[model samples]
Target chain A: MRRVIKNLISALVALMFVNAAHAAGELHIFNWGDYTNPDLIAKFEQMYDVKVTITDYDSNETALSKVRPGGHGFDIAVPTSSHIPIWIEEGLLMQTNPNEMPNFVHVAEQWRNPDWEPGRNYSVPWTWGSTGISVNTAMYGGEINTSELFFSPPDELHGRINIVPEMNDVMNMAIMYEGGQPCTTDKEVLMRVRDTVMAAKENWKSIDYGTKEKLVSGDVAVSMNWNGYSKRAREENPDIAFGYPKQGYPLWMDNVAVLADAKNVENAKLFQNFLMDPENAAMISAFAQYANGIAGSEAYMPADLASAPEIAIPAELQSAGVFVPPCPPEAQQLYTAIWTEVQK
Target chain B: MAETENTSSVLAAQSHQVAIEASRRNKIRNFRLLSMPALIVLTIGAAGPLLIMLVYSFLKAAPYGGVVWEPSIDGWFGVFLKKDIFDGTISIATAHLSILWRSVNLSIQSTLLALILGFPTAYFIATRSVQTRNLWLFLITIPFWTNLLIRTFAIMQVIRDQGIINNFLIGWGLIESPIEMLYTDFAIMLGMTYVYLPLMVLPLYASIEKLDFRLVEAAYDLYATRLRVLWRIIIPLVRPGIVAGSILVFVPSLGAYVTPRVLGGGKHLMLGNLIELQFGQGRNWPLGAALSIFLLCVVMGALLIYVRVAQRGTTEHV
Candidate 1:
């Protein structure tokens, strides 16, 4: 009986060790809805022997508001470029310093040290895309590569245009249309911005987020659309094509960062480094049809995708894209009022 | 001896009746005692969120979509008035009024539409035999089993340009081009009518089923024509049902966000969507809270009016 008891104790201890080995850790990721690539998650989970769970938020405000007060139990989050400074100022994110990670060299030269995250202290680029106009070639074949397609649609496309419900994108484009920089505080520019959009609203059929479905189904012949969604829509309907708006467009990037109070700090840091790898970053781009800032990720992407017009902006038009960062509280209030009046 | 026994039995019967009445009173007291927890839960559950909303509405707006601790009436002011962005002149918030008007307009329109459509349906069901009546009701409730979002999407599928209706029209060469019907005010109204039709029908059926049709025959015997009998007899009898159905359809329509969002094309703002904007991209939580409370007040006002009319209708029934 004594010998049997000894054996049972040893077996129990062995079982506990096995459980510990199997249970590496768990990571809870809060990201934009329908944005995360499942393959990348699966690969990361297998690589680190950790469980990965993702929750989604539809907008930057939602992401910020939820994470602001803490206790969200999220290890990582992907927030848009415009809201990054706000998140940093709120101290909701931990400085993971991706520049110190092994995979930091894979980040493209231009994106290696952005003004928002100098030396990549806090975040890594998850995906980047531009908001531009997408037109159905069969509808009106005229100059589709311009903001005029959205703000001053031709007679043929009148009442057939759809503007996406992104307030910043619409307001920024309108600002640019009046020969002003984005997030400009000048009252005159802001006034023209309001007037331009308000007048444009008449020609537009809808201001909606589901422009991809609307475009593919031919519900709207023209739409102010995001590049990735336009790419997906074009895949469904070849006649639907995306064009970089010449009168400036919004260049936005969603960055992955660790939460300040994350329990799995090591795992979160590992995931941040994992996203910088070319193959993994390429997986993200493939799923969302967005462009990743990883150097040589294109080698892993499909030939059509690597050279897709929606992915590759032309030379002259490349300079037209601007990253519209967060406006100050006062400027934001002004913009909000203008937005309300426009939609109202 | 027989006289004595009969008197004793009568006294015993009267005592037994008294005992039964006493026990019934005791049971009522026990029921009230047992219901305390549920009453407490209801009061807390329903009123707690409302209290929070009331408090939030009076607070100052935070920069990035929350309220500051400081109290201010800016939210309420924003609801009825606007400080112009350009000239900095304060004026009546016609934009807000327009949204409010849209919500009210849509609710009223949908209620009437639901009545016209549901009245006939409920009547048809009520006129059927007992076996068929339940089957027809079962059919009316079949739509409810599916989720509301799914139903709205199904409507979208049926009406989109490349969807079944357009496809069918084009296939048969009925018209040269497909009609754009998916993203109009008509579409919003149609979706609402489809969604809340059952709410209208059920109440109308409950009252119509209890309707005394003998009055109709009596009216006819008094030389009342078909239209006159319908106006004087059937309509008057179903007044309670009409009010109930209208309230049921109208209240939800006023708070409707999904149907209008899906079908209204975002060209116009409804009250529910406007409130949502304040909480979301508009980044003004105080405004959202104020808007929510305002909606609650509207709903309460509606309910109070309904209660008064319903009381009168019930009294008239007796």
Candidate 2:
């Protein structure tokens, strides 16, 4: 009986060690809904011989809140640039060691050290896009520069425009159109954006997020939208025209960041490296129609897209684009207050 | 004779005792079984989140992401301060209150419309044979099986400029450009009426089914006119059904999000939409919680008003 008991105890200890070894291969990714190509996860799973679980959030704010609550059972997350600084400040993000990502060298030099994450220590640039007005050129006489199509369209088409419900996009567009700096922590700029938005509230047909399909279906004439959506819109109907105001276009980047308390750090790092591969980055960019940070992704892009004026970032237009940083609590509150009032 | 009387009495008493004990045991067993799942569902689904929201609403908004645990009434107070009507503060613009008011208005309007449209049809079905009634009820329910989101989108397609109605009109040369029918108040009304119509019909049908048609016949025999019969006798008979159906349609309509969001084209930001925003983009859980609490109050207030009116009417009849 003593011999049998001793054997059983030793066997149980051995089994527990085996279970710990088996747990390292699993990874959980939480990202924006419909943001990733379906084949990417399958490919990652095949490459690493690990299981991947994916979840989705509609906004950066939603993701942040979920992560702040000890995380929503996710190992990897893709947050927009605006929330990266805040996530870092809150100690929610883990600074990934560059040595772990062998493919990190393939990212574009310009996108490598964005202002949002100074050292590119915390985030991997997944896709970059400019927020602009995507319109049906045939319906609207000509290409328009000002964001006024959203706020102050033709009286006949007053309620026929769709604007993004996102705070920063709407607020920044308002300020930028008024010839003010985009995303100022200054109180005067915020108040001006608020007043401008409030004045045009009645003209807005809809304030939508994640409703790009509605735009493509001709539900709204002109929609304040992202570049990827505009690309798809034009692909579906060739007449769709995307315009970035000469004033400036609010540029955004979605970056993959491993969580601070991620259970599968090794697997997360592996997945991040997998995403950084030029071929894989090209696949995601083509499928998602968003610009990738990969140095060679442009060569793999479709011919029309490769030569597309909007996709081709010119030096002159580069200065017109601005990156929004994670805002302070007071600034967020002020924006929310203005938005709620405008809607009312 | 004495033996026969004793035996009969004993058997009757024993049978009664056995039945009572069997029922008692069955009741306890069923209660124990049912209470476990009921408690679990309530704890997980409703009570737990409600308790959390109650806690979070009093706490400060997280500087970066969530709410701080330290309790403060700032969120609730934020719901009350009157600011420039355009400010997002719950207190200043009072959007939550406005949403609540609009929800009540739309709910009442749609409920009344459903009652009007559903009552006659339900009464017709109820007066028919059971086979016919079931067939009609089944027909009424066929639409509900489809996804509500699909139905809403379909409604949009039917009313949009490139939709069938507009295409037919333009083809016939009835008008010029396709009239904007998609994102108007009319579209919202039509969507609400469609979504809640079946709800109105089912309850009204059940109520009218149990109503005695003889009562109306008897009134007619006593020389009461058809209008008088319907107004005084028929309606009174199905009062409970009306109450039940009204509650069913009104409650859901008041909290409706998708239909208004889609059909109304975000123009009609209802209570549900506002609550969704607060919990979502607005990232103001305290305000969201307060709004939720305010909606709950409105619902309770409505129920109270309905019960009072119903009670008063009942007393008058008595």
TM-score per candidate: 0.91, 0.88
> TM-scores for chain B, in order?
0.87, 0.85
Give the TM-score (vs. native) of candidate 2. Answer: 0.88
Model 1, B1-318: lDDT tens per residue? 898799888889888888998999999999999998999999899889889999999999987778899999999998888898789899999888878888888888999999999999999999999999999999999999999989999998898778899899999999778788887878888899999999999999999999998988899899999999887789888888998899999999999999988888888878888888888878888888999999988888978987797678667756
* lDDT (C-alpha, whole model) for all candidates: 0.89, 0.80
lDDT by residue for model 2 (A83-185), tens: 7888888889888864347888898899877898876887787898888888877778654665777666777666667887777788877777777776565
Residue B141 shift from truth in candidate 1, angstroms: 0.9
Worst 10 residues of 1 chain A by lDDT: A112-121
TM-score of 1: 0.91
DockQ of 1: 0.52
Model 2: how many Å of interface RMSD? 2.9
Please provide, for model 2 over B102-157, each residue's C-alpha lDDT reduced to its tens digit, 9 standing for 90 to 100: 77888888889999999998999998988888899999999999999999888878
Q: After aligning candidate 1 to the native by TM-score, how far in Å is the CA of B23 from where it should be? A: 5.8
Model 1 / residue A250 / CA error / Å: 0.4
